[model samples]
Target: MRADRLVSLVLLLRRRGRLSAATLARELEVSTRTVLRDIEALSAAGVPVYAERGRHGGFALLPGFHTELTGLNHDEALALLIAGSRRGAQAFGLGSALASAMLKVVDALPESHRDIAAGAAERLLIDPEIDLLSRRVADEEVPGTIVAEVRRAVFAGHKLRIHYTAAGRPPQWRTVDPIGLVTVRDRGYLLATRSGADRTYRLSRILAAEELDEPAERPDRIDLDRAWQERSTRFRAGGDQVTVLVRLNPARQEELLDTALAVRAEEAGSDGRLRLSVTFQDSRHAEWALWQLGTDAEALTPQWLRTSLRDRAAAIAARYEPP
Candidate 1:
């Protein structure tokens, strides 16, 4: 660890020319005394490191001193830098590792491209904790220990035993052959099979996990995309799916489409509104989504859904009518 820190110290000086002891300490997350000692170590090792005196005094590498670390071009470096900004790695319990790797990546880039690539990456943002309305998007917390165990099983072709908490149910322990992990919309899921039946478990819902010594019963090589698609198709087809026809304001079409499971049909209304026949996971899902749109959308068919929405509106209106 100290060796890596020493190398990073050299690279930091090489890139920035001169940095105060406090700045070096902050960048390397070490004590100022540690930076001073490392500077001496570098100097003793004939690394052309020296310190200046006075208020602006700091450590500096000799002029024209640089290590050769060239490989990535501009675009490639930018892409990698942008990837380092993602929070997806945090979902897999690798946040610290990702940060360290990103630091190493920047250090290894050619000096000519390092600052520009890193600076450009700062301009790009990834996940946001809050939306435009100030409503927060809460990230699901997956235990690092659990994630480590599961990840190890997945990569090592071993089975895993987990205590999973399904919706409105008690936690039950099950042994599974994990295929891979997926993160979507900030939620992480472990794609696995139990008793040869595909099962998806939310990582947050895993109360306990243990990797088994036995090998997993899965293909030697998996195409995760293909596997995920097949499982998704089967899941969508097996759910309590319902179709609802709705008339919505053209501007609100996206809101409806975003929540709908599928758009069965679409047409423009004579009144300039949009007509959409869409599928929902269930009646409750349909009711909740349309209710959010208020006057912007109307349930055209499926009289039961229209009735439910009307009753819901009536209830809300009754509350504020008089008393």
Candidate 2:
């Protein structure tokens, strides 16, 4: 917080050229004495900051003082601003504060570059759905206080006392050593290790969570990045692993080959139809794929799948016919 207040003071001086101690204090919500001490600290750190004592005089950054902002291209800057706006500006924790800090960076840019940045921001509109999905999962629906406390516990390596209610189960209290938080498909999950278990719980299922004062040693083996990668790989690998054989018309064969779901293809008979071998995650996904090909495609192997598809089709047909 002190570091944030220091940065804020620097940006304020950079923007307004001169601000009184009282004004800086009011803006930063600190006392005038605190503002003066912060200015002294900034000057001590070789920031070229100074103050004047008199009516209508105040603290100001010396002329020609500039800080370099790195790694941001035109598109990146626009994208960053657009993302901040979509995060509701205030709900992104430090992101909102960082967004405000970006304004000073924009102010420091040359007029031509500034106009380019502004134009890009206005022309490149990020869709709301994509923006919403990009936010921190904990911030999506949970109260700010809970999100903050959980984050604190995770960072401090503290244990959490939580009341969780799984689907089809009664709510019960459990003590978990908070490992980390993960966002999967826009859902927030607490990657905690419970007593005698190795898996984590989704935080949304938690009816109540409170941080404990006791700290625990951080686990060296709990790599979040690796866990995320493994989860994605396993999910993709686990989808119906059955080898499906389908006969398709020539035109339908071309369509099927163009799709990501098509795993393999081969000529079926002299009639010029094709036998496609595909690995699908589930019968439902395969059925959907077959439906997209309409009458041109027919399942050839896995009799159970074919029978199931037929029964489903018959049931669907029965719903529409005259009783």
Candidate 3:
């Protein structure tokens, strides 16, 4: 706990540049005595942390104390910037601050490294396709005001009042205790505690958000990273666990196994036919898979699926009939 407190104190000084013992104690949920002891530990560890005692004083890091990013190679630094850009560089609450910080870092780099960094930037380009019709399916810019509120709630253990719309539903306002933000694919999600439970909501669905004055104590036993991982795994697993048996030719079998879907291949008899077992999230998705296989694969089990596949084929044939 002391180690954590010390690290947090150092980061706080780095981010805010100054903080009072009372503020640090409240943020870290410790007493002023404990905070002073942790500060002492940090100073003992050569953290360059110092405290001031007066009417207009607290604790501050010595001027010129800064972390150096000299270890990163040129390619690595450019990769970081490009990655940031993909996450809505202009829309993130810290985007301008990050850009300013990056400029300072670039200026501090050696001349040779600067040239390499420039070259890498010129060579890296990200072209994301924009879809304008569907707000639900598009990546919209996160409002700066909302971004700030979310960050404050996450860091300070405060609750947030958010106006949001669930999929296929009208907008409604609710209070959520902020936890963390996760980016799935290119979209952003807020993992929060709602109605005494954890839930994930799309950032785009949030019309407005604000921090509450009331603070919720941080959970003592929660492992947020592990909780997120388990939730994501269950979400991927719960959708239609149906397995389809399909017969594929040797050439198509290889291609099917290389696809994004989970497909298991096995030899069937000695006639160059292969058996493939595929799991789909839903019957509709399974039907789409069967459509892609076309005439190359045939369903071997599950009478309902086989019948559905037959009906679909018949419908397609009827469509191609006379006119």
Best candidate (score: TM-score): 1
lDDT of each: 0.86, 0.72, 0.74
Q: Roughly what TM-score does model 2 have, to 2 decimal places?
A: 0.50
What does candidate 1's lDDT look like per residue over 216-318, in tens digits? 9998888888888887778667778989989999998888888888888999989999889999999999999999998999998899999999999999999
Query: What order do you get sorting by TM-score, best first?
Result: 1, 3, 2
- The digit string of per-residue lDDT tens for model 2 on 180-242 reads 776544456777767745446665677777899987445755888787666556654765566
Which parts of model 3 are misplaced by more than 4 Å?
A: 1-64, 68-85, 88-101, 110-112, 126-144, 220-224, 237-241, 246-277, 292-301, 316-322
Judging by lDDT, tell me the better candidate of 2 and 3. 3
lDDT for model 1, please: 0.86
lDDT of 2: 0.72
The segments of candidate 2 whose C-alpha lies over 4 angstroms from its true place after superposition are 1-116, 130-140, 220-222, 231-302
Per-residue accuracy of model 3 over 103-143 as CA lDDT, tens digit each? 76788778998999989988876544544654453556788
Instruction: Tell me how candidate 3 scores on lDDT.
Output: 0.74
List the candidates ranked by lDDT, beginning with the highest.
Answer: 1, 3, 2
